[model samples]
Target: MDKPDQIPPLSIDEISILFFNRQNPVYIDVYDQQTYRYFIYPIINRTVFFGCLIITLLRPLSHLERITIEQGSSTLALELAKQHTLTEVYYQKTHEYFTELLEYRESELILTKGKELGLNMNSIMFVTLFKISSYQDLQVLEAIIHRLVSIIKQQMARTEKIVYGFHNKVTLLISLSSSDSDHISSITKLLDSIIKEWNRKDGPPLNAGIGNSYYGVENIRKSYDEAGKALSYLTEQNRPGMIRYGEIGLNRFFLNQKSEEIERFLNEIFSPLWSHKAKKNELEKTLLVYTDSNRSAIQAAEKLHIHINTLYQRLKKIEEALNLSFNNTEDMLKIELACHLKRTFNA
Candidate 1:
C-alpha cells in the first residue's frame, strides 16, 4: 500500500497516518441524495476527482473519531472528527459498497478525533475546473486527477483545484503557490502531465490557462482573467495544451501595426524579391548590401559575390516591383522598417 505523502517542516512522530499505495484510491460515498466518489491519482502530486461513492463512505468514517485519507474527499467530516469525539475513521479503498463500514469498525473513533489529523489551515490551495468534450474520458480522468491532487495536498500542503468544464471542449485552469517567481513546481508538474496526456489522446487542440498566485477572493478572479487571456492568445503562440499568464505578457510585442499584419509587411518591404521570385534570405541580403554600400552598386555587387551588372539587374527588378526609384530615401525607410519587423519576429 502507498503511504500517505509526508507534509513537512515539523515533527510528525505521534501523528497517525493511513496508507493506500497499490493504486490510486477511489471511494464511493453515498450521501443523502448523491453518491460522492473521491477519485485519486498522483502524478507529480495533485489529487483530482468527484463522485457519489466518496460521499457515501466519508459520511460514516468521517463520523468516527479520526481518519486521515491522502485525498481531500473526506475532509469535511474528518476535519471535525476529534473535536466532536468521533475520530475513529480509518482505511483507504479502491472501491465497493461497504468499505466505509469496515473502516468504522477498524477505527472505532469518529469525526471529533480526526479534527487535528489534517494540516488544513496551513494548506495553500488553488482550484479551477475545465469543461471537456467527451463524457467518456471524464470517468477515466477522475481517478488520475484525484491521485494528483492528494499528493500535492499532502506533500506541498497547498490546496489546488483544476476543473474540466462540462461543455464542448476540455478547458482547464489550475492555480498553485510559488514562493519564488522563477519556480512553480506544482503548477509546472500539472502542466507537464496534462500536456503529455493530451498528446497521447490526440484530440482537437487543447486550450488551457494557468493562473498565477493571488491572495484574496478578488485577486483570484484577476488570476483567472489572466489565465483566460493567456488561453485566447494560444494561437499566436501556437503549440497548445498549456499557456501561462506570464507568457501572455510577452505577446504585446508581436501585435500587428497600423497598415499591415507582420506577414504582409514582410511582403511589401520584400516586394523587390517577389518580381524576381527571390527567397526571404536573398531579399534580406540585398537590402543589407545596398544599405551598407551607401547605394553604390559596385560595392554592393562585390559584397554579394555578384558582378556589378548582375546587381544592377536585381536592383532594377526591385525598382520595377515597388514602382519607385532606388535613389528615393522614402523607399529606403520602408525597406529598413520592414527588415526591422522581420528580424524582430525571427529573434
Candidate 2:
C-alpha cells in the first residue's frame, strides 16, 4: 500500500493575467487536445486541477472574454506564420547565392547579391574547409554539423562568417576587419580552439584545410579552390590534421602541374618497377625509405626494420631494374623528384 500523491496548492499571484473585452455572450470551454482534459484555471469558489500542480485565477472567463482570447490567439499565429515564411525565403536566396559563389558562376552577380544581403565580401580573409570522417547515419551527421556550427558561432562571436555544409564537409569563410593585423594568428588560434573543444565534446575528428588570405570578393573562388587543394592533400595522406595551402612550400608547384605531365613523369621514372607486379610494391617502399632516410643505408635499413645486407640487396635490385645508378647525383635527383611528385599528386 502506498500513500496518495500530494497535489500542489494553487497560487494566483505567481501567474500573470491578460484582460480582454467583447460584445457577444456565449458559453465556452477550453480543452487540451493533447492531454484529453479540460484546461485548468482556478477561479473564486471553483478549484481546477492540472497535471501535477494547480494554478489559480481571480474570476472565471466570461463568453466575451473567450471570444476576445480566440481572436487575439489567431492574430498572433498569423503574424508568426508570416515571419516564418519570410525567414524561409531569405534562407533560400542565401543558399542560392552561396552555391553560385562556390561554383565560380557569375562572380559579379554574387558580389552584388552579397552586398544587397549586407554581407561585406571585401572583409573576408580566409576560407577554411572541414572534412568529416565517414559516418553511417544522416541524422548523426546532421547533429554533428549543427553542434559544430553552433559552437563556432558562439566562440567566434561574429555573425558575419559564412558557413555552408556539403556532402560531408563544411566550408567557412572568415572575415576580419581591415585594421586587424594579426588575422592569420587570430584565425589559427580560433580554429585550434574550435578543434580542441569539438574533440572534447566527444565529436568525430575533422581534417581542417585553410587557404591563403586574398583581398576582394573576386578572389574568393580562388581561395576556396586553394582550400580544396589543401584538403586533397590531407585525404591523400589519410592523416587527420590541419594543413594550410601556403605552408606546403615547393610541393605547391608540383601539385599545380598538369595531370598528364605528372602521369608521364611518374611512368618514365617508375615504369621498370611497375612492370614487375610481384616486387613493385616492395621495391617502391624500399626506394621511398632509402630516399627519405637521406640515402643512408644504415638509417633506411633501420627504418624499414630490415638488415643492412637485405637493404643493399633491394637497392641493387632496384638499380638493375631501372638500369640507373643510385650513386649518380642526377639519377638520385630525378628519383627523388619523381617520389615527391607521386606522393603529392598520388600519381
Q: Please name the candidate that would achieve the greatest lDDT relative to the true structure.
A: 2
Query: What is candidate 2's TM-score against the reference?
Result: 0.55
lDDT of 2 by residue, 1-347 (tens): 02112222323212212101122223323233321112232221111111111222235657886666656545654564465446446545655666676675556777777766546777756788888876766644654555465567678775457765555777788766663557667777788778766655445777888888777666677888899888877776676678888877767766556678888988877777764447357788888889888899999999999999999999998999888898899988889988877766676
lDDT at 129, model 1: 25
User: What lDDT does model 1 reach?
Assistant: 0.44
Name the lDDT of candidate 2. 0.65
Q: Backbone clashes per model, in order?
A: 87, 0
* Residue 230 accuracy (lDDT) in model 2: 85
